[model samples]
Structures are given as C-alpha cells and as structure tokens.
Target: MRKIIFICMVAATLFACKSASSTASTSTEATTLSTKLDRPTQVAIKGNWVLTNVTYPGSDYIKVNSFDLADSKCFIGSSWNFISNNNKGTMTLNSASCTAFTSPIVWSINNQGLFVLKIVNPGTKSKNVKEGYLLKVAGLTDTSFQLIDNINVGGQVKDVTYQFQRAN
Candidate 1:
C-alpha cells in the first residue's frame, strides 16, 4: 500500500538524519580533545610533573588503601620527571604508604602516537612492584599536563586519568 511505503520512507529518512548528527558530534569531540592537548611533543613533556589528582570509579584500587584517591593524600608529594634528551624518566613517591619509592622509567610515543611509560627494570627484589601504562595525552600546557590510561578490570577495561602540574 502507498501508506506503508510512505511510512517506510519516513523511517529511513529519520534514521539517516540521526546517523549524520551523531557523526558530526563525534567529529566535534575529537577536535575538542586534540585542541586540549596542545599536541604535546617530546620537548613539551620534559620537566617535573607533580601528581595532582587520580580518579577511578568502582575500583578496588581505592579500597586497597595503597592506591586510594578519595583524599589524594597518598600522592601529595609524588613526582614524575621526564628527561629531555634520552626519553628516560623517574617517579618519586613521598607518601607514607609508598615512601622512598623511586624508580627509573623509560618513555616514548608508540606507533599509534600514544605515550608509553615503561619501567626500566622491574627487578623481583624490589618491594615496589609497580608497572607502567600507555597514556593518552589529554591536555598539555607550559604549567600543566594531563594523561589517561586504560586498565583491564574483571574483563572490562576502564580508563584512569591522572592530572599533574609542572613543578619546575
């Protein structure tokens, strides 16, 4: 019937419009995220970065007391320094739970252009058995920087964003 044909046409047209709108919105979001980073380069990421905040939802990491972010006191004096010439870095933890935790790390941008932080030597003898993660540069400026990393939890991957401020 003509009525059925008309209804089908309307439905298809509506679906098309929605798809176009969603595509446009996604493009806008990508642009926004790119702009926020200032497109941080190797030189831009060099220097001292003091941990400012850590956030993860429904994570047992918070309950462990070791990685708690509720008060941010655990990372109050933590610092990460990225060296300019060699792509090497260091992490210093000053909190009581993680005091004297300093380790050498290496960093580089992966093929996908995401930052990758790696521990130079995760020796079995060390008490601090922390590893590194690949980070997405969220935002970068002269005095501030932000990064996000994804971790798998119970088969579901979750994103954890860490914010930092320039120390020097």
Candidate 2:
C-alpha cells in the first residue's frame, strides 16, 4: 500500500512539473503561434510595397476616408514598408494633391487571413490603441497582393479593394 501511494504521488508531481513547463513556453510563444500566416506567407509579404490603387464598387461616386487618414484616392501611390520580421512598418502619403504625412503601424495576419492593423498615433504604443481595422487578404503573390475591406455603401456592405505592388 505504501509503495503504491508513493508511486501515485510521484506521477502527480511529474505531471505538475510538465504542465508548468509547457505553460511557461506557451505564454512566451503564443504571439507567433496566434496567427496561421506561415513562414512563406510572411516572407512573400515582408518588404517595401506601394499602394497602386484603391477601388470599390461605386467608387466613382462615393468616397471613403481610408484608415481615417485621408480620402481613399489619396492613398494611391503611397509608400508602405512592411517588416514582417517585427510586425511593424510605416505608411507615407506621397500624393501631392492630398495631405502629406507618414505614420507608424503595427500589423499582423490573423488566423482567419485578416490583416489586422493598428495605426499608432504619433507617440503612442500599439497596445494602448483600442481601435484597429481588419482587411481580408487576397490574390497574394510575389509581385502583388490585395487587401479587401468591407465597407458600408448606401446601407449595404460592399468590398473595397486596395491593390499593392512590390516596390522596386
């Protein structure tokens, strides 16, 4: 009876230690594993890119304030730098006809293939910013990709596609 009790206690201790070790590693590694964006996807997307165009249904009539930064048309020809290694980058408005500015952004591709982005206002940390935008990634390729944002147009949801090209 004594030997059985001792064995049971040792087994329990072993499980407890194993659970603790696993929990420690998971907490630290969770961020990377949180998304299903594989290494290849990350590699393909990490680089300098340009916003070639922003188009949507009825775009010829309605206007959109993209990211609350500027008119959707103004985002065309913008310079964007995406560094997937650190999930951070910058977007610069280069359109001469619109407000010229640049902003820091933190981003990630979530498991659902949503491009989750938080535009960090001037001097704030990404975590403190409670608002973000989610865009579906489509037609990703070595030379190009598209971010499709669902928007409300005339009380109905419509797709707004932002096309990107790999910068030279």
Candidate 3:
C-alpha cells in the first residue's frame, strides 16, 4: 500500500510538469507571431515616396523646411521608389538644377534598422557622390515615413530629420 501511494504521487507530479511546459511553449509561439506582425518593415518601406519636410535641430534653435514651399521648389518633385524586389531602387528629380535627372540606387536595411542607400555609378551629367549613406529610421507607416541622422555642422552635432509621404 505504501509503494502504491508513492508511485501515484510521482506520476501526478510528472503530469503537472508536462502541462506547465506545454503552456509555456504555446505562450512563446504567440509572442513570436505578434512581434513579426507588428514589424512589417519590408512591406511598409516598399513604395514611391516624396520628401515632404526636412528639419535640422540644433542646441539653440530648429530650422524646418517644407519641400512643397517656394524656397524648396527644387525638391518639389524629387522622389524615391523602393522596388518590388528586395534589392534595388530608383530616385528621380524634376529640378533643372539637379545634375542627374534620374539615378539608380541599391538599398538595404541593416539589422540595426538603419536604411542604407548606395547610389550606383552615376551618369555623366551627375555629380559624383559618396556611394553609401546611412539613415536611421525614426518611424514608418503605410503613408508616412521618417528618417533621422546626426551630423557635425560647424563643429556642433545636429540632428537632421527627413519626413516622407507616399507619392501616390
């Protein structure tokens, strides 16, 4: 009778442990799925986007420019398209002052969530620019996107933020 009682208790404890382990596994799976759904970066950033605004924030003051305004007319029709496939993209500018009318770009997002854009060998009319530029993604949505960068301006570190909107 004593042996039977001990066996029963041992079996009950094993069953309870198995039940708890199953619940934990299910909880972990759900959390992983939620994270994946919340961050749909590849899909969200794929589209034609036009620069809507640019801002420079300094220690003392902030300067903001709306691309639609007269002073920024040069960038009024400047746009970028992250193509359907994952690898390449394009930038087009309508301003006469721009050296290149259109440019081919190669782009990728790093694990750190920075957007890296590299202009391919530019055409003869284009000014040679450093191939790679990294922009920190501030926010991204179906219609709106924002990138932020910190750069040294006149020996002071300033933040430059760019806001973009879906062109279509």
Candidate 4:
C-alpha cells in the first residue's frame, strides 16, 4: 500500500511539472506571435499604379488614371491627393483640377494584410465619408505590389487587382 501511494504521488508530480512547462511554452509562443504581428513590414509602395478596378456604389469597375505615393503623400492623378507629412494626415479633392472627390483621410494597417483608409471632411464633423480596404497580393516586388478591393459595393466583391510599378 505504501509503495502504491508513493508511485501515485510520483506520477502526480510528474504530470504537474509537465503541465507547468507546457503552459510556460504556450505563453512564450503567444508573446512571440503578438510581437510579430505588431511589427509592420516596411514595403516600398512608392510609384505609379494604374487603377485596374475601382468599385463604388452603382458603379462596377471604374478605371482610374494613375495613383502616386511620394513623400508620404498618396496622389490619385491631379484630382485626389492625400498628404501624410509628419504623421499629419490631410486629403483634398480637386474637383476642378483632375482628382476630385474627398479629403482628410486616415490610414491604418490591420494584421490580416488589410490596408484601411478612412476619409473625413475638413469642415463637417460627420461620420466617415468614404472607407476602403486593399488586400495585399502574394508576390511583393520592389517597384510593384498587387492589391485587390472587393468589398467596395454591395455586389459580389470582385478581385480588382492592380500592379503598381515604381516610377521614380
């Protein structure tokens, strides 16, 4: 009886140690995963990219002239221009010029490779005027990166992919 009890105790102790070791390892893995996701991978997305697909309400696929990202400024032709200088974000729509639409856009990246842009007006304190998402393509290149925006309209989200090539 004493020997049986001793064996049982030893087995219980072994199980407890194993459980503790596994819990510690799992905690370490969780920390590592969070750190990896938080760190943004800097990709050079500066260049001229043709808008192969742009989906708006009541519009299927609209062809945009060209989009440019320079000095933290995202310019869509001469009509729409967004400047993110010094982390100060501002967007302007040149309806009279060429790029016309909106301004004061806020940009952020989520873990799921989704680039989000929230457009807000300057004077009006209203909700987000326009919101969009861009999905990252698999093969990331030095000059060009492919992106798809599907959930723009209510219809089926089509893969409007664009390959942005570096200009300067």
Candidate 5:
C-alpha cells in the first residue's frame, strides 16, 4: 500500500509540472505572434517626386525641378545620385551639363512621420570639409513629401523648403 501511494504521488507531481509548462509555452507563442502583428511596415521612397517649394532663412523659393527614385538610385534632372547603406557616392548634376560632387549622407525615418537625412563630410587625408546637413520631410503622402532643408550658412541657420511629389 505504501509503495502504491508513493508512485501515485510522483506521477501526479509530474503531470502537474507538464501542464504548467504547456500553458506557459502556449502563452509565449501567442504573445510573440501578437507583437509581430502589431509592428508597422517599413516605408520605402521609390518613384517620381516633384519639387514644390524651397524655404530659406530670408527667402522662400519654389522649385520647378522633379526627380525619380529607383532601387537605391535617385535621378534629378540629368544628375544621378546613388545611395548604398549609409554611404553616399559621387553624384553628377546634369540638368544640362554634368557636374560631379560628393556628399556623405545617412538617411533614416522616425516614428513621428519624419524622414531625416544627415549629411557628414568625411575628409580625405589631404582635403576635408566638415559640414553637416539636415533635411526634414514636413508633409508626406503616398507619392509626395515636402522637403525642408535646414542649412547652416555663415554661422547662421537657414531653411530651404521644397515639396516633392512622386511621379512614378
């Protein structure tokens, strides 16, 4: 009788532990799915965008220029700009003629519906220009974004705002 009772007690304890473990595992799986379903989709800027406005410190200007984005490449007029990862390669401005310039920029988006572009100047061993640029997307639509360029000029900060409407 004593041996039978001891065996029953051990079996009951094992069953209880298994039940608790299964419940915990099930809840954890549900939580994982819930979190994944709640996550927002990432945004990618691709297609044609038009320039609408430019706001500067003392003046505001409207841009008649438009651009297109494909893959990681951006085409402005005749100029082509390529962005890979966080590195910006040399771009050629070819509205009519080709002019080459290099700008180091890091692009990111925030939860506050803002597309931020940070420009960093990586100096070469012989030449270096340490300048920074900040561009904020003020208003954004499915195919458009209003770009506000805040520049530091002559120790004073200025703003150049432009509207970009996606074309493609």
Candidate 6:
C-alpha cells in the first residue's frame, strides 16, 4: 500500500506539471486560451516595430478587418510596441487615408508560437475586453517578424501575413 501511494503521488505531480502546449486550445478569445510566454521569443520581440506590409492571395482586391480594428491597409504603417516583461503593449494606426486610431494592448506569445492579443479601448481596461485575436508568429528575429492570420476568402481559407520590421 505504501509503494502504491508513492507511485500515485509521483504520477500526479508529473501530470500537474504538464506544459500548456500539450493541451492548447483553438480559441481566439485571449482570456480562454493559454497565453504562456515563450521567453526567447519574448526577449527577441521586445521593442517598437512597424507593420511594413500586409499581404495575402488577393490582398489587392479584398479588404480585411485586421484585429477587428481597422482595414488591412491601415496597418501598413502602423506601429507596435511590445513590452515582453509584462506582456503589455500598444498598436497605433498611422494611415492618413484610413481612420486614425491607436489603442493599448495586452499581448503574449504562447508556447505554441501563437501571438495572443487583446486590444483595450482608450479608457477601458484590458480585462473587460472579451474578444481578442491569435496570430501565428513566424520568422521571428531580432529585427523582423511576421504575424500570420487566416481568413475565409470566397468559401476558402487563405493566410493574411503582416510583416514587421524594427523601427528606427
């Protein structure tokens, strides 16, 4: 009986220490998903960056509402600041042709290499923002990175890529 109890305890401890990526969900809502920070990625992406480009299969023809905040074109010159220490940041839209916008954001890069972001309104708190976005982080380097989001186009799925470069 003593041996059996010890084995059970060891098993329980290991099970409880399981990584989140082993059971990560597909939910887009930040609050419902595991936003575990990838320390290496966190350190690499900490700084100000600009959305250099936004592209997809038919990007020229269709307009996508990126992050449900602004048109995809509006993000071309947008600025993003990621503070990895606390996983907080801000995204500012700089398109003079589109609606001017900026907002505080809470963000994290999960173990699954997903960038989870919640955009908080100017006067509203981030915790109250129920909706959020999850984008796959790809080709991340000290100077550049890309966030890839999938959207349904004409009943088919396509990837929308947002390229970012370190701001001078």
Q: What TM-score against the true fold does each predicted structure earn? A: 0.58, 0.77, 0.58, 0.40, 0.39, 0.80
What TM-score quantifies how close candidate 1 is to the native fold?
A: 0.58
lDDT of 5 by residue, 81-111 (tens): 2243432423233333323334434433434
- The whole-model lDDT of each prediction reads 0.59, 0.78, 0.57, 0.37, 0.37, 0.82
Residue 6 local lDDT, model 3: 100
Segments of candidate 6 deviating more than 4 angstroms: 1-32
Q: Lowest-lDDT window of 10 residues in candidate 1?
A: 21-30
lDDT for predicted candidate 6 compared with the true structure:
0.82
* 9-96: candidate 6 lDDT, tens digit per residue: 9999988774444222223322344545688888899999999999999877898888777789889999999998988898999898
lDDT of 2 by residue, 2-58 (tens): 999999999989886522211101101212224344556666789999999999988
Among all candidates shown, the one with the greatest lDDT? 6
Model 4 misplaced regions, further than 4 Å: 1-39, 46-99, 124-134, 151-155
Candidate 1: tens digits of C-alpha lDDT, residues 22-120: 110110121111211123476788889998877766654543132222334465568889885776888777777744567776665543456655555
**Winning model by TM-score:** 6
Candidate 6 TM-score, C-alpha based = 0.80
* Least well predicted 10-residue stretch by lDDT in candidate 3: 22-31
Screening candidate 2 with a backbone cut-off below 3 angstroms (N, C-alpha, C), the clashing residue pairs are none
Q: Which 10 residues in a row give candidate 2 its minimum summed lDDT?
A: 21-30
Candidate 4 C-alpha error for residue 103, in Å:
2.2
**Which candidate do you rate higher for lDDT, 1 or 6?**
6
The better-scoring model by TM-score among 2 and 5 is 2
Better of 4 and 6 by TM-score: 6
Q: Flag clash pairs in model 1.
A: none
Determine the backbone clash count of candidate 1.
Answer: 0
- lDDT per residue, candidate 4, 18-108, as tens digits? 2221110110121111111112322333223333223333333443322222211123222222232221244443334453544554443
Task: Order candidates by TM-score, high to low.
Answer: 6, 2, 1, 3, 4, 5
Ten consecutive residues with minimal summed lDDT in candidate 6?
Answer: 22-31
